[model samples]
Target: MSDKLTKQSIEETFRELSNWGRWGEEDEVGTLNNVRPEDIVAAAGLIRRGKVFGLGVPLDQPLQSVPHKRWNTIHTFMQDGADVATGMFEGRLQYADDAINLPTHSSTHWDALAHVFNDGRMYNGHDARRFGSKGFPVNGIEKMANRMVGRGVLLDVARFKGVDSLEDEYAITNAELDACAAAQGVEIRAGDFVLIRTGYQERFWSRGDWAGHTTGMAPGLHFESCYWLKEKDVAAVAADNYAVEARPAEGEGFSYPWHGVVIPAMGLTMGEMFYLRELAADCAQDGVYEFFFCAPPLNLPGGSGSPINPQAIK
Candidate 1:
C-alpha cells in the first residue's frame, strides 16, 4: 500500500496531529482547552455595534436534494388551536405545543469528537465501541456546550478570490487561507472560532440548486489544511459547505479523510452546513471579520453531535 493508505503511515499522521493527553488522560473537550478564560473576555470585547448574525439555515425546510441517508427535519404539532377548540384542555389557557424529530446532523450542526473514528478508535484514543445505540459514552456533545463561546474570525475566501462561489471540488489550500486572512486584515489567533466562507451555501440560496450544493462537487478546505488549523490553535473551524473539506475525497479508497484526522486524531470539533451569507456580507462591508461568537450545543448527554444556531455579534 502507498504511504497514504498504509496503516503505519496513518498511525504516524495521528501521532503528529493528535491532541490526546493535551489536557489530561480523561479530557473530552479536545482543542477547546485552548480557549482560556482570557479568550472569552477578549471575544466579548469585540462586540461593538451589536450587529448579530445567525449562522444557521432553517431546519424546517426539507433538503430532499442531497443523496444521503439522513432525512429532513420533521416538525409535528402536539397541541394547537384545533386541540383547544376540541376541548382537549379544560383550563382557559390555550397553548400550542410541538415536537421535532430529525437526525442530529440534519442541518447546521457541530460534530463532537466522537462523531468520527480511526482504526476503531475515537478522540483521545477512546475505543470506538464505546459509542453505539446509547450514543457516545465519552466525548459527548454535552462536554462541549460550555466551551462553545469564543472569538470568531471570518476568512472569506470566495470574496478574496473575486468569485461568488468556488468551482466544484476546489480545494482551499493553506496558502489561500493565509492570503485571505491577510487581505481581510485579520490574524487568526489561538482559541478563535474560525469561519470559512466558500460561498457554496449561496448557490442553493440563489439558484435553488440543492442537488449541486448538497450532492454534487463542493469547495472546502484541503485535507492538509488541518495542519494549518493545528498550528493556529483554533478552538473550532466551520464552513459554509456540506462537509468542511473539499468533496470527491482527495485520498484514494477513503472518504472524508479530513474528518478522520480532525475529529478522531486531533479531537477538533467541526461545524458544517452553516449559513454564513449575512455574516460574510457584513464582514466585507465593514472590513471587520472579528466578532464575538457563541453557539452552545444542546446539552444532549451521550450525543455524538447536535444542531446549533450559531450567532456572530459584531
Candidate 2:
C-alpha cells in the first residue's frame, strides 16, 4: 500500500493486506476460518496440567474506566426483596437478577470486522455507511461466536527482552515478535490465537496509574505487523493494551490505523485489555507456551464486540 507504514500507509495497506474475498463473497468469520476440526483436537491435547487461567479483567470495578471515547459499564443489581434476608416468605428463598448497560468495546473484548472501515467499505467490500447505521449487517461479532475455539500461544515480549515492560508508546516491530517467538522456543502455526503481553496491565492496573497510561500512550505492535499476521494465518491476535498497536503513531495519521486495516480490510478479529499476568507467569514457570484457548462472545447479532471471559487451560 504505502510502502512500510509511511504516509497514506493505512490506505495502501488496507488494499494490500485485505482478506475481502479470501473466504468467498459472503464470508463473515474471516481469519477465524483458519481453525479446523483437527486444530481443536490438537488444542485439547495441551490440557495436561488441568490449570486454568482467567484472561479477562474484572468488570464493574475501579480499573474499568479507560481513556478516549469508550465509557465504562454500569451494572445494576435487583433482588425480589427490599434488602438481604428480607425476601418474601421470611427471607427464605431469595434470588437476584442484574442488568447491565455496557458498551460493546469497553473492556476485555474482541473487536468484530465491523469495528472499522476503509474507503467506505467493510469486510468483503460491504458498504460501511449504509449497513453500519442499520446495525453492522455483514461481519458483526455473531459470525465468530462459534469459531474462537483453538490453541493459544503467549509471547512475553517484555519478559523476553529482560525488561519489566516496554517503554511507553514504544512501537513493537515484526522483528521483535519473531525474536520473542524464537526465544520462547515456540513454533507459531496456523489457527493459533497469539497473545502478546506488554506488561501494561500488571504495571498500570496495580499502581492506579491509569491516568498516566490510559490517558495517552500504550506499547504495542507496529502497523506493519499486519503483513506478518497475514503470513502466519493466525486465527486471532490480542494484547494487554488497547488497540493492539502502539498509540500516537510515529507518522502523522489517525489514532489506530492498524485497526482500520486488520479489521475492516483483512477481516481479522482482534482482542484487547486481556488480563494475562497469571497466564504469562504459568507459561514462564513451565516453559510451555501453547495451551487450549477458548473465548466465545455473546450471540448478540449486530453486536460490535462483547466483554469476554477467555480461559487458557494448560
Minimal lDDT window, size 10, model 2? 1-10
TM, every model: 0.95, 0.93
Query: What are the C-alpha RMSDs, in order, of all predicted structures?
Result: 2.3, 2.5
Clashing pairs in 2: 1-12
For residues 68-154, write the lDDT of model 1, one tens digit per residue. Answer: 788888889989989988998877888999999888887899999878888788988889875579787799999997889989999
Local distance difference test, each candidate: 0.87, 0.83
List, residue by residue over 103-195, the lDDT tens digit for candidate 2: 787778999888777667788888878873557777888888899899999999989988877877787888989999999999889899999
User: How well does model 1 score by local distance difference test?
Assistant: 0.87
The TM-score between candidate 1 and the true structure equals 0.95
231 in model 1: Cα distance from truth in Å?
Answer: 0.5
Model 1: worst 10 consecutive residues (lDDT sum) = 1-10
